[model samples]
Target: MLNSNLLRKLDMQDLMVFIAVYQQSSVTGVSEALFVSQSTVSYCLKKLRTSFEDDLFINTRTGMRPTHKACTMYAHVLKILESINLCHAGPATFDPTRQAVTFNICAPEYFEHLILPRLLKNFDFADLPVIVNMHKLETDIPADELRDGSLDLVICFGPNFHRSHPDFKSQVLVEDDLVCVFDKRATPLEPRFSLQAFVERRHVFPTPWTSTTNMVDGWLARQAYKRQIVARANSYSAALKMITGTDFILTLPRRIQKLLAKDTIFNHCEAPNGLPGFTLNMQWSQNSDPDSANTWLRDQVLKACAEQGLS
Candidate 1:
């Protein structure tokens, strides 16, 4: 067992430093995040190392990585910090028009394009003096960060949401069907887009999922067919651009077609039969659900969806 005396010497600040270093993997990052000097973070780590009797983090080429012991200790340390935060967090009485607050939300890039404007407009209309931050989301949910309150909300595809995580609650925001965009001038128009024609065309695949594969590919594989993916684009419009004036095709959410239809060269067709549509959902941890600030922030997004007629 660790020496009880040394453990008693460890303070909340030291634990906070430890958690920050673990998450960021850089002393400089922890220093900046915690508003402390690098030396101060180093000093806290030194004290923590003495108490734990282990080098919790080790420097490597990429960054400082947590040791096995440190990895195991992370959950316990996080619980301690969370419990402390709960003790100090009394009833939240907030006024959006008067109180200054910050809301951090993570979602795919298209959400920004489609919903952010309306959300911002609503915020401005109310004269709410608050900061809004939108972070680009990855395929994997940042469950730990959400549970610990670092991430206020997450918006992800329905299939990608971690439904098994009991601590999270989710609501479907929108359901979108896929539409294929290509240069009508170059490719012959068929009333029906056959699966064979779809698999035969060169494709500019949209990504941040996988360079070579995605859900569509998985479906094609199950049917013993696959598309020719020639290039990868991070954005749907970029993918459409690559396929413009050529036989290459880009399949993306139908919502984007109207926005890009002004480009007379491009044409849209319904995705091939048997392909499934997708849904986007808004998710939040139970820890944040009851917070007045988070509730108001969610209201803005819902209003934005209503503006888009996404009921």
Candidate 2:
């Protein structure tokens, strides 16, 4: 027989708040962690104290110190919360090929221009009832949105521009060398290009990040040579347009040049020998690592990269 008094007093949200308070050890921390108001956490704590017939947490100089009762409840509350998550996740029954899913991805123009077309061309996702919503990449790691289920995946240039967290998983998906693009009619260069031409010429930088500096510039700085950046465009396509029929040079990834090979208007040359290549990495929340749908999507991306010889 179950006790109706305890059952009536129990609330899932209160238990969640209790668990959060235990973990955070501060009312403000709990509020932010759970995305709730401090007053709401206080209300939940009051209910927890009444239901348990004890002040679960004691205010201390350092933080909210857990009482003996709270210490005992911690493991049990954790299990309950995890069980609730598993119930909602339903990974055991997930079938990616037939499941209805909407994936929200955060990516930069780099992914859009280079990888997405190949992925779409090689895979049939629309028929599978899969919709991919792309959001502009904001940071090296957008953990807050990913943690709250606002974003399913993130793709960005790395390993220079990467921040790792224990709750997220990342993998390098593709790599490519650098090449310098110029309009041959406007800024003709011999097959034997010299580093002097690279520095003497004005350059157009294409990058989504606010900073115009990159690995290329870092190498140049090491050698005490800095290329003059005449213009900074928000994307590579824009930079290409800005430099075409002009003397401005745009140095970008070789894969980008491969994609634009048909455009006779722009010609690419081997980058200064020592300039390093770049890598693109894909990241996802750890919670999604075991999800069948996520697994399928990641596999599809890898397949596209392998087929396109871009891996």
RMSD for each of the candidates: 17.6, 15.0
Which pairs of residues have clashing backbones in candidate 1? none
TM for every model, in the order presented, reads 0.67, 0.66
Which residue runs does candidate 1 get wrong by more than 4 Å? 1-91, 160-163, 208-213, 261-263
TM-score of 1: 0.67
lDDT by residue for model 1 (1-311), tens? 55568898899999999999999999999999999999999999999999999999998887889999999999999999999998898667567877778888888866776787788888788787878787777757778888898888888876653435777988889898777888877555785478999998888888733223466887789999988889988877677778876888887777867666445688778778988787888889998888877887787788899988986
lDDT of 2: 0.80
- Name the best candidate (by TM-score): 1
Best candidate, lDDT-wise?
A: 1
Misplaced by over 4 Å in model 2 are 1-93, 122-126, 209-212, 261-263
**Clashing residue pair totals per candidate (backbone < 3 A):** 0, 0
lDDT of 1 at 79: 100
